[model samples]
Target chain A: MLALAFQLARRDLRSRYLGSFSGGAWALLQPLVQLAVYAFVFGYIFRQRLPGADAPGYVPFLVVVMWPWTAFAEAVSRGTTAIQDNASLIGKVALPRAALVLAPVMASFAIHGIGFLGLLLVMLLAGAGLAPAGLALMLPALALLFLFALGLALLLSALQVFVRDIAPALPQILMLWMFLSPVFYGRYVMPEWVRPWFDLNPMTGFAEYLRYALLNMPAPGLRAMACSVGAVVLVLALGLFAFRRLQRHFEDFL
Target chain B: MSVLVEAHGLGKSYPRVFRRSDRFRSLCSLLAGRASGEVTPVLQGIDLCVPRGQSLGLIGDNGAGKSTLLKLLTGVLTPTHGSVRVNGRVGALLELGAGFHPEYTGRDNIAMAATLQGFSADDLAARLADIVAFADIGRYIDEPVKHYSSGMVVRLGFAIVAATRPDLLITDEVLAVGDESFQKKCIRWMEDYLEQGGTLILVSHSMYHIQKLCRQALWLREGRMQASGDVFEVTQAYLAHHERKSAADEARARDLDAVRGLEFHVRAMRVNGEEAETLPAVEQGAALTVEATIASRDGRVPVVNVGFARADGTPVYGVSSDMDGVQPAPLPDGDFRIVLHIAELPLLPASYTIRVHPLDSEGLRLFDTVERTLTVKGRSSESGLVRLAHVWEHAAPLSRSRGE
Candidate 1:
């Protein structure tokens, strides 16, 4: 099953940029362009910065959170439509159906993860105040974030097979989710009453932890960390349960 | 022999999703672990057991669920009712270019298909040259599958399946698209595969192919098993049903009341003592008695003619009383009765129609006709309408070749 998932992920990645001139380089380049646009809008125009005077630059602060968020958002949006997109394959071939959902998630993470690593290396050399040791320390957090995205992906992809509105509405929902999370700004920028409520949003733990690891910023509270971990475990279990229950009926509806 | 495939009360039904709301409702119910309501059943209650080395043909009309059964057996589609257990690796070529991604090159699709069949990368690499060679599509192997002709698609599809050499092969009418040469190559490969103890399940509209390849056959009609057994019997029965359906359509166009007004018309026609539109099936070489009662509007002698034809309207033989230098015997009620009996009917096993016509005394100017369907039942695989009487000369006995 793992081998099949890898084969499908490779196929998915190759087919995405098959006819393009830049080919796979576009996977990394697209996110770089998005980062440039965000840097211009927030760093230059809005003059967004971290709270403390000793904080790292605005671009690195945004880069750490934005890259992982892009991976999560792309993974969820692409994975949601995986089953519906492969309706012809599911009806004709007998294979592990979950692999279809897993492929897109794996592809998203692989492309964005490589881009994130390369950008961090470049920042470290540019004297952006990023801790070299924190890069090693952040591996566990990155792995956890992958599981969180995968859990949501499995859940949404299964629902998308039956309710097609999920795929079309996913982009708007992810945009709202990103704005609500601490992607563009820190939770400290929000009003005092809402600061504590940020713990409920799983992305809060992720965004704060990435900054804390790489930018030497304040870490997320223990309650927020526990809440995010609990959410991942609960969502993963629900996703697996829903997927296993609904996978067999996919062909009938498709 | 160990069974390679076993299915019991297998069935499938699609949930009715005419409205958008139904899909949502079905999702909710399915998630709640309840059966979705309002389903249209496409197949039901199919029981099959195919032993290793056995070749089975699936014969059915369009929409008869032959493809559905094949999908269930191959584990492509989940059965809604019962279970199917397949104990070996199965290779299936369902419909045209099944499991092929249109945007991918044929070579790429082969790798994907090989992976789906549980072949490791090394296994596919070893057989890659053989697959490309067997397909024989030349440079089209590197072209996108959507750009290839339908015949080329089947060639590539069949070549991959042939290379897999699965323990059980299930194909669904895909061979019909291939050119004759490619088709012959596939059949030759399948024959060799079968000889090596591979099991097969085949679906084809052409009974000739079924009879040539399969030893056992199953007939499905309206999602139900009509008949299953020896290939000859099931295929013959399926063909006969089709023949009767077409004959019935033709029979509806000719009204009996309109024919009664003719100068001389056939009043009744019977085959083998039974007077019905369709008679019971008769064994091959069995005696057949065709009796016809002709009514003459005027008190004049009428000549009777008996003709045998395949149900598709291919005439086999025709004979008239006048040709035999005889006349129909007149009855007291002013009707003429003629009986034509063949000591041994030489017709092969298939559906045939017997036509009785009343003509004037001169054996010309046929007035009216009545037809009855006769089915010949046997295990003979001989081709053509009738069996010819002949002898093989200077032929050695089979035991002599084996030195028994």
Candidate 2:
């Protein structure tokens, strides 16, 4: 099953970029451009600054939080429609059903990894000198973000087969979701009443975890990390249950 | 031989949703413990077993659940009830090129499919050359599958399946496509595969191929098994049923035209001066005659036409009284008797139908028709609908060549 999953992901990655002249370089282009836009709008135009952030500039602060955010958002949004798009393969081949959901997540993870490394290189060249301990802390945060996205994707990909509204409505939902999380703006800027609600959004811990790791900001406390992990586990459990139940009739529906 | 597949009481039903909103409603209701749409039951109560090294043929008309049954056996669609236990690995060609990605080249698609079929990377690398040689779609193997013709796509699909070499192979109507040469190549490969102890379940509409390839046959009609037995017996029964159905249809068409408007009516038809209600048997190349008596409403002489047709409704020959410039003779009873004659009928040993058409004076328009089915019995071992008379001559005497 792992072999098949790897093959499908590799094929998807290759074909995705093969259509353009720049090939795999195009995968890095979109995120880099989006990063530039955020830097211009939030850093220069609005002149935004984090209240308790140890980082000096808004662009680095935003990049630290938004890199992982981009991966999470893209994986969930694209993963929702992954099963529906591969209805042909589902109906024809007897494959491990989870492979379809995991392929998009894995592909997005690779692209995001490259973009994050590029940003880190630029930040180091600009002399931020991010600490090694904080850099090591980013690994666990990355894993949590991946787990959350995979869980959401599995649940939604199965539901999207029956309720097609999920696919079309997800991007709009994710847009609202990104705003609710501490993506461009830090949680410190939110009104105190809304600050607690940010903890309820699982992405809050993921974003803060990244910010603390790369910018030496205040780290997510153990309680907040526990809440996030608890939510991720719950979603993962429910997602697997629903996905396994619904996949039995996938061929009929497809 | 061990049994490779055993399916009992298997069934499949698809819910019919007329609108997109209805599908949504059904999904909502299904979660709420209530059913919402009409269900179409496609197959039910199918019991079948295919043993190792034995080929089974699924023969049926369109919408007879043949394809559905194949899908169930291959586990593409879970059955609604009952059990299906298939032993050993299975390779299926359910729909030609169904799993192929349009944007991917044939070579890339092969690797993907082979991996899905449980081939390790090293194993696939080892067998890749054999698959490419079998497909033989040169140059196009590196091109995207969307650019391939339908035949090329089938070649690539079959090649991948063949590379896996599962214990049992299931195919549904995919052979009907592709050029004759490719089809022959596939058949030869299948024959060799069976010889090497591979089980096969083949679904097709062609009886001749089924009889040649399969040891057992299952005939389905309207989601039910019509017959299951040795290949010869089941196929013969199916063919005989088909013949009876077409003959009834021909009879119905004749009866419908007999009462149409009644400007001209055919009273009686006689074969070889002997009147009969049904078709009469005749020897091949024997003298035959068809005499028809017709009654005209205005006492105007009407043209009578005679036609010969094969049992399958293909027109063989037709000649009208007006076409031959022969005028119908008026009888004393206010009717005309038209006679069509043949010194020697040139039909092969098969059943045929002779039809008569009554037209108004000129054969420009037909008013009524009557027909009789004839069985031409003969000792000649000829094939096809008609037998042409010819003498065989030796190009060079066989004895001279042998002596040399």
What lDDT tens digits, residue by residue, belong to model 2 across residues B1-404?
68899998988888786778866776666545454467788998899888778899999889999988888887777787688999988899999788899999998999999888888889999999999999999999999999999999999989888889999999989978878998998888888787777888999888767866787899999998999987766775575467656866646655655454577888888888767755556888999999999988889999988999876787899988888788689999988998888999998766677888889886677887777777776544455668787877866655422110
Q: Kindly give the stretch of ten consecutive residues in candidate 2 chain B with the minimal lDDT sum.
A: B395-404
What docking class should model 1 receive?
A: medium
Candidate 1, residue A16: how far the Cα is off, in Å: 1.9
Write one digit per residue (lDDT tens) for candidate 1, span B1-404: 99999999999999989999999999999999999899999999999999999999999989999999999998889999999999999999997888898988999999999999999999999999999999999999999999999999999999999999999999999899998888899888888888788889999999988998899999998999999999998999889888777766656456778887888988888888898787999999999999999999997999999999888777999999999999989999999998999999999999998988899988879988788888899988889988999999999767422111
**B57: Cα error in model 1, Å:** 1.6
How well docked is model 2, in DockQ terms?
0.38
Clashes of each: 0, 1
Clashing pairs in 1: none
**Top DockQ: which candidate number?**
1
lDDT value, residue A37 of candidate 1? 87
